[model samples]
Every structure is written in C-alpha cells, then in structure tokens.
Target: MPAVLVLLLLSGFLSRAEAATVVARVDLSSQRMTVSVNGVPRYSWLVSTARRGYVTPTGVYRPQRLYRMYYSRKYYNSPMPYSIFYSGGYAIHGSYAVSQLGGPASHGCIRLHPSNAATLYSLVQSYGRGNTAIVITR
Candidate 1:
C-alpha cells in the first residue's frame, strides 16, 4: 500500500511537470499577475488592467507575438516595452507609469513594472509561445 501511494504521488507530480511549463495568470479584481513554471509559482507582481469604460478580456490565450520594444499607434504612440500580445490589440507590457500599477489604469492592456515585464518576456521567449499560456480571470 505504501508503495502504491508513493507511485500515485509521483504520478501527480509528473503530470503537472509535463504540462505547460509556463503560465501567466492575471486576476483583474486583485490587480495582480502570477507566473508559474511547472506548477511552481515563479513570479508575482502588481499590475494595472483596464479602467472604467475599457475592459480587459478574460480568457485563456497563448502568446501571439512578442516585441521587446513596441509603441502603441492607437494610443498616442505610447511605449509598451516587452510586450506579449495575447489578444488582438491587448497585451501584457511594461509601462512607464510605475505609480499607476496595482489598479485599473490601463486602456485595456495589462501593465507591469518595466523590469517585471522584461523578466516575463524573457520567460515566454525561453519557454516558447506555444508552451506558455495566459489565463486572465476576474
């Protein structure tokens, strides 16, 4: 029985580890982002989501593209460094408005500290866009 239990536990671990290695979970209500690797929490940080009228779409997504340095043409040429574009125009990116994080301040984008965004970008790149999933929830 003890051997069987040990095998079961190992099975669970292997399943989780064999699954997607990188996942970025965003909680809109909490205004936070958590990244996990192989079922282990890797990084957690405050983030800024959409404001009043704007809405940040909540769904499961794989990164569509990555831009280390990008500017928003729709938003007065605003800077969006380390952008991980998940949805059409929405993305997880670094913002210059560090003071505005941890709240609803974005125009529908997920904003993070510049350094944190860079770290996340690197992780996505290393893990492969197809291997990383972004799960946004309210």
Candidate 2:
C-alpha cells in the first residue's frame, strides 16, 4: 500500500513538472515584455515593436522556432540574435538599437536588449516549445 501511494505521489509530481508554462506578454502601449513562468511573473523588460507605418500584429501565439543567431534578408541583413519566432516572419529578437527600446522602432518584430533576449530564449528553451506562449497586445 505504501509503495502504491509513493508511486501515485511521484506521478503527480512528474505531471506538474511536465506542465510548466512560460509566457511572454508584450504590451505595445507600454513597449514592455513581461515574462511569466508557470503563471508567476518572473521578469519585465523594455522592448521595441513596430514604428510609424509598420504594424506589430496583436495575438496569442506559441513559439514556432528559435534561433541563436539570424540575419534578416528583408531588412539590410540586420542581425537578430536569440530570436523566438512566434508569427510568420515576426520574431522577438535582440536588437542593437538599445536606445530605441521602450518605444516603437522595429519594422514589425518585437525587439529586446541582447541580454534580455538571451534570458527569455533560455527560459523558453528550458520549458519546451509546447509549453511556451507569446501574447502581444495593445
């Protein structure tokens, strides 16, 4: 009986561990990204999303792919480090334009400081793609 109880407890613990969720919530108005792990807010960082004529789509999406280093063919071969692609051609990536952070600037993709982008990428990688969500809003 004790062995059966122990087995059940272990199963429950494992299930919980496997259910971890990481969410990156981007607020366009504030130009900030708030990262939450398992529904608990973990970190908040400044970000840049779309400037002037360009638009950053608002929706909830799961990360489709990750790249440690990527260069944009559409935009002057711009370097995008620690990129997390959540929408078609739209990614949350590290930007060299640190001075433009916390304001609209990017063509469309969300932009974070390199270190912050790396941190977020690591969190999503550790949590697994199935458990990661990206939510962009006004």
Candidate 3:
C-alpha cells in the first residue's frame, strides 16, 4: 500500500511538471511574443520594447513577480496591468498604448495589449514561476 501511494504521488508530480511548462519567447527584431505551453505554441502577439534611447536586455529569465496592477515608479506612475516582472525593473505588462505595439516605444520594458497581458499573467500564475520561462532574443 505504501509503495502504491508513493507511485501515485510520483505520477502526480510528473504530470504537474509536464502540464505546467510555459514559455514566453520575445523577438526583439520583430517585436513579437510567442507563448507556448508544454512545447506547443499557444499565442503569438505583438510587443513593444525599448525606444530609440533605451535598451531591453536580452536573455532567458523566469518571472520574479506577478501583479494584477502595478504603477511604474521610474516612468511617471504609468499604469502597468497584469504585470509579470522578470527582471529588476523590466517586465511584460499591459499597456494602454495599443497603437505602439509591434514597435519599439517603451522606456525598456516589454509591452503587450491589455488582454494579451492578462492571458499571460494568468498562465504564469497557473503554472508558477519555476515552471515558466521568459526568453528574449534579437
């Protein structure tokens, strides 16, 4: 009975690990984001990264924090909804500037349409940070 219980626990753990795998890949050159779950592409959305004078760091990262709504302290209290902060102050968040998506316009963060941001926020929350990855590339 103990062995059977152990097997059940292990199977549950393995299933969660497999089901929770989430990846958000950002392409800087094209200003697009692709979201995948368990190795299957699920969403492709436009994104806005750093403007002419700013830079969006490129690398792989795990989400550091999640916020339903956040105000940027460095950028004049701009509203950042459904924020998934991956780096120090850099995040993937909802922006009101929908027209600026698919182009470079932010100070240095990745911006997405409000609904897309909410979707991503929900995915990351459901999966947990350890099971999610954020990859930014040129």
Candidate 3 to truth, TM = 0.86
User: What is the per-residue lDDT of model 2 for residues 4-60, given as tens digits with 9 covering 90 to 100?
Assistant: 223323646224444437778899999999887766788999999999999999976
Using TM-score, rank the candidates from best to worst.
1, 3, 2
Worst 10 residues of 3 by lDDT: 1-10
**TM-score per candidate, in order?**
0.87, 0.85, 0.86
* TM-score of candidate 2 versus the correct structure, residues matched by position: 0.85
Q: Candidate 3 residues 20-98, lDDT tens each?
A: 3778889999999999886678999999999999999987778999999999999899999999999999999999999
User: How close is each model in CA RMSD to the real structure?
Assistant: 6.2, 8.3, 8.1
> Any idea what lDDT model 3 has?
0.86
lDDT of each: 0.86, 0.85, 0.86
- Runs with alpha carbons beyond 4 Å of true place in candidate 3: 1-20
- In candidate 1, stretches whose alpha carbon ends up further than 4 angstroms from where it belongs are 1-18
Per-residue lDDT of model 1, residues 30-134, tens digit only: 999999876678899999999999999987777998999999999999999999999999999999999999999999999999999999999999989867778
